[model samples]
Target: MPDSASDVFDIPADVLQRETARIFRGHGLLPNDADWVAEALVEADLRGIHSHGVTRVPIYTERLARGLFNPRPNVCVVRQGPSVVSVDGDNGMGAVVGRRAVAAAVDVVAETGCAAVGVRNSNHFGIAALYAEQLVAHGFIALVCSNAPPTMAPHGGRSALFGTNPLAFGVPAPGERQILADMATSIVARGKIILAQQRGEEIPLGWALDPDGRPTKDAATALNGVVLPFGGAKGSAIALLVDILAAVMTGAGFGTDLPDFYNDLDRPGNLGHFLLAIDPARFGERDRFLERLGRYINMIGDCPPAEGFERVQLPGEVEAGLRRKHLSSGVPLSQDILLGLRQAAGHADVSLEL
Candidate 1:
């Protein structure tokens, strides 16, 4: 088993993916679903988003082993109208259900030029960018968002009433980087707090408040308390919009109805997500759109930065760059996380090879 005194393990991406899949498969997941979960987790790690990566495998598999979610869901889809499609996830893993939803939207948009797919009864799907990036890869503009478990306080309120409520968008740019952005409506995601706690670091003030409505720097206190909204009322308002579309409109649990992912081990999350896609070809030629996007990227890069900043960067640039670097060197995971994952795998007699 891994220990803190050891150097951080640098596992090959492919090896980590297979090990993750093997552990999930041992826990009664289908081969395809196991693979999907593994790949999604590895991708998040590769992109340097440790909060959404393999660090989550222990909690996920624990819930799965305890019968919190369906290992194999009979996901169903219904066409609401010419441009609307409804998906029932049947309590499936978020990544697996999300892939099915995006695939359905792609099929519908091919004929309708645009489509909206609403999803319900899913678990935390890792990262929203993973879903939106699919549309960008297929030459379509996509918007994706999800409602999480309640952790953020509404504007001017002391009690937590909303999830971080993330929003993600991806637009295709032929010659330029993909316009992919995934952000939380709060000052920071709940994941960041979890990460800080794991690393034993204090958080910056204004990021979160204690349970009694006092600003806090302690990560653990913030997790038990409330995460603050980004721009006071504005971010809270956006979180509300996301909750409405991704949960209320999708016929899934909203606000107080959702279960706590960290503590609740035997109950399904009943999470929901929403996806909207538009084919650029419908508005104009694909080549023209790509070229225009490249122009805008160049124009923005040419601007002068303020004294404290270096150069301008787009939304997806940093993560994309990190991915390229990690792919060659392997992903660095802390000994604590590696040991936890090892313990989880060991229970199933799965060899992690970390």
Candidate 2:
């Protein structure tokens, strides 16, 4: 363990994945589904997004055991066109549903030079970047969006009326580096607030509002309240666009109609996601595209920093740096998260060494 007060103990990435898989399998998920789900969660943790990491394992396990989620959903491609496809998640794990959609999109793009896919009846798919990165690895530009449970309010509306609605974009670079941008439309993701609450910490004033719509530092109250949009109206507009494209376009539940990921375990959460893959070679020379991208990145990196700042990083640079550091050092597993995983393992009849 690191001596720093803010630092956390790092566990090997494979250990975390095994533990996660064990817990999920205990809850009745098939071995393959459990492996994919665990991989996605562990990958998120490795990328430094602790909010969506193993901390969520217990909740997922409990939901699955309680019959809130279908452990063996028959996820299938429901419709197919030359450039477009649609999938029915059949209430299966979100990671499985998301991977299937990305695979479908990649196959279509390979043949037609471009493809778009919409998925419905899925659960939370962890990080959107995971799917986008798949396309990036295949020499394609990827765009992904998903509609989440309502956590944000529409502009001028005091009640929660919209989802955080994350969007991800990824473009392959010349070398191993890829330009990836993944973020929620809200001022802060709901996962961060949940983490703060679990740690008994308070959040910044602007991250969320109180139940009465007043800014508050309390995480629990903010969980009940509404999260603020990223750029006020601009972010609200983006959230609306994501909801329409992911949910409405896919004929999934929209707005307040979506089920809660945790609390409501009786019904299937009709969540939706959209993925697009564009083959750069279709429009321009691959090398030329990469050269221009490299130039743009260099220009951004060369920008003069303000006082106390050292560099201007692209969207995924910080995450990539953190991932590199954590991969070698280990991933941090908080006591609370560990306890949850242990409890989930016990419930699933799996013995966890941690």
Best by lDDT: 1
TM for candidate 2 is: 0.96
What lDDT does the true structure give each of the candidates?
0.90, 0.88
Q: Residue 3 of model 2: what lDDT?
A: 47
Q: Global CA lDDT of candidate 1, please?
A: 0.90
Instruction: Tell me each candidate's TM-score.
Output: 0.97, 0.96
Off by over 4 Å in 1: 1-7
* Root-mean-square deviation of Cα positions for candidate 1 versus the true structure, in angstroms: 1.4
Off by over 4 Å in 2: 1-7
lDDT of 2 at 251: 83
How far does residue 160 in candidate 1 sit from its true spot (Å)?
Answer: 1.3
